[model samples]
Target: MIAQRYSYLSWLPLLLVSSSHPQWPSSWRCIPQPARSSVPCYCSGRQTWAGSLCGTLRIPGKRKRNEIMLRYVVALSLLALSWAQDCQVANINVMQNFDKTRYAGTWYAVGKKDPEGLFLLDNIVAQINIEEDGKMTATAQGRVIILNNWEMCAHMFATFEETADPAKFKMKYWGAASYLQTGNDDHWVIDTDYDNYAVHYSCRLVDADGTCLDGYSFIFSRHPTGLRPEDQLVVLQKKTDLCLLGKYRRVAHTGFCESGTSLDPQ
Candidate 1:
């Protein structure tokens, strides 16, 4: 299979922290997907948006960063499971129509928060590839909260629809079943059109077999970048997806940019 690489995030001091439009369940808390992040965002932990940053708290960092992160965000990692899990988790398939190829690319970290605790992959990047093997390979670079600052690189594998319709496919990247409960049942993708340049990822509260419950969803687009601001006010409305705008953010800048002045930026 052919492969390509892209550019790194230019260090930019933020003007302000960006928040998301998420409908959080009372029982679930939001957490940053990445291990290190500046601002806290709301997410279910099990399912990540299309192009947003995502990482669980794997290693404890400085006492300060740990305390600060836990105050505002949920803990889904091994370090912080004792405080939550008071309710039952729902199960469902949420990706029946979402497209796959359109979802490939680099996405930046916007926001995240979960019960497992707060995690943000600061200076983060997600590189997803649909290889000949049909399995998705994810390469990510970000910082883990440590005594100083731990910049980490992680490689993860996700399995996609083997029996799913190619037209509308689904993908499962991670998270344990318990963490996924009370969220989307099974992370489904009900609709997607590769040539159409648009589609979404969906999840449910139940599984096909009914053995487990915990679902999530993440929508994607054929185009890399998100809908333009002017388009949102007029012709282009902010389309909805499982991951919301997170999936589309930085999509144009992922694993391999569609076209550019330089594919490898040093």
Candidate 2:
């Protein structure tokens, strides 16, 4: 069987909605309807390509109620030079080589980059799986050794994103950290091995006016439990093309992960 390892979440726009993959059952989660924005965005839950925010994802219609909101945002972004700055995008491969049918299951995270405030994600792991109707599921878990500050509620939820063309379909994340639906960012799946074990994530920056910024990239993989740590690291290193900002580290073992900053990393 070909390993459909290519799965990672990307940023979602406020108008769109989607999800990350967790080893989930074949049932799709019904998202809450979006609050309704004048200009909709594409969003997901996976740090990169989880899913867009909402009960269902299809570019939301511009609400008559939010028409003013849309005009204001477009005008504002058009004037900012920063908004014009190049955006961070991914060179991720949309693992189209394999049948999407094979990638329907779960995965765990074993490593990640250690940024100044991201300690909450250290030792944190994520699960990935696909639903039969075309939705994706992501179950994120983190073990914070100490309760200190590096702990937050863990989460398990299901939502929908994109899987249109296996080779061309990429992932994106959006909305509240806990709600997988709402405001969003734009992350794209830039690279993936046809075998589906490894994937690269990147996204355009989210500017002050809600526009995408320069593109940045990261390598996400099945936990070391699935791939050899050394081998996974090798694959990561080979992706030097990614030019990541920092090095990978174990997520802080915050035993409290599940719901939100208000909850824990269960």
Candidate 3:
């Protein structure tokens, strides 16, 4: 039976090469081997060709090809998504034609996204005032741990300089005490209803890719308790737009800095 099979297969090359089998690949040649041999017959190239003709021929079929194509498609899709969500700092939008008068007064920090080397921890509150010359100045109080483990209520003040965009300002801030954090930061009002909620953003460091490397955000509310139910949805949407949605932690108002005698920044 083995001899007969081999004899029958030995004519495969002549059959394949015949004009009657014009569809057969010219590169493929069937050279019959011993039945006990692992490769009884083969086609040329890296891929074992003519898989349908040779039952033992190991070749990548339609399913495997589809899998390879699918993998490429998935990788490209992920790369595109990453590009879409790059969160470029220059592309971030701030409030249009922001009214300074409407934005003044006390704002309670309801949610906060902290930056690297965060100073404020919780119980944050900000008081904004417009000076007689229409300059904006703010005073903020928050709980902070400095000198490694010494916790204290921080009294901070900031003076904002006008920029080309009304909603954007360059903030020069310093703590009342010498031990507190002090620096110049970019202040942008992302969104503000003035009467209810306001979103503030600051980027301390921008990466080479035009994305914010070190930044912070504050979700402020007119009320001390936090944003109202209806306003929560609006704030949530703003948080998502800022790309700092899940990065925020609730800012508690435990009155840690409220009762403390805050020193006036000279």
Candidate 4:
């Protein structure tokens, strides 16, 4: 019987090549032997192929094929979703018609969302100035807590490199000494009311998964206490637009940076 089956299968390739319609339907099933015949046959539901002329064949597994296709589809969907989230975060809104001259002044950090390696902790303040060469520069001072619970007043300075857009800048900053913040980082002005409040953002690094690995944002106000109620609502809305809603903590200005006491890193 096994020899006879082998003989039947040997002619299958030739039969398939000679058939006018060689494509096999997915629903096809192989029958070992038909009810009225002593030969193997091919049947789909109630329909059977021509008698013993039908060759012995193995039908492919539909379930296995479906599983493989499903995996490919799921992987593509996840990749697309990751790209979309990255694009949404990258195309953030910024202040229109931002005048750097008008924007130059003292600003207080009223709210902050710190990322990894953040040097400034609280009592943050910044003073912006227009240099004689018409370049923008800033001095920022804040209270920082270092390793082993050591606290100190940190005075940092930054020079802005202008981009095509007036509202965006590349800030190169360093501490007054060797132990403070030092890096050239992207600085974007999300939105600013000039006199009342401002929203700033920085994306330090992006991950392979199309998400920000290290990023920070600051909500600034002209007053040390914090933003006014009306200004707060505007700043909060801008924060939400940047996808940073509920990520910030209130920054208190208790004159920590202004105190005469200063400690240098050992």
Tens-digit lDDT track for model 1 on 1-266?
00122111211011011122223332333353443444444445543332322233221123433354455455345225333322222221233454455656654432221222322233335566788875554544433343355323322234555444443334455422222112211223334343322333333343454422333222233334543343333212222222233333332234322223111212
- Which portions of model 1 show Cα errors greater than 4 Å? 1-96, 115-118, 147-157, 161-227, 230-266
Task: Name the top TM-score candidate.
Answer: 3
Using lDDT as the measure, name the better of candidate 2 and candidate 3: 3
- Candidate 1 vs. true structure, TM-score: 0.32
- Model 3 TM-score, 2 decimals: 0.67
Ranked candidates, highest lDDT first: 3, 4, 2, 1
lDDT of 4: 0.74
Of models 1 and 4, which has the larger lDDT?
4
After superposing candidate 4 on the true structure, give the runs of residues whose Cα lies further than 4 Å from its correct spot.
1-87, 263-266
lDDT of each: 0.34, 0.40, 0.77, 0.74
- lDDT by residue (tens digit), candidate 2, 82-117: 444433333333444544445444444444533222
Q: Report the number of clashing residue pairs per model.
A: 69, 105, 0, 0
Could you report the Cα RMSD, in angstroms, for every candidate shown?
A: 23.1, 26.4, 12.6, 14.3
Candidate 4 clashing pairs, residues 3+ apart or interchain: none
Q: How does candidate 2 fare on TM-score?
A: 0.43
Task: Evaluate candidate 2 by giving its C-alpha RMSD to the native, one decimal.
Answer: 26.4
How do these models rank on TM-score, best leading? 3, 4, 2, 1
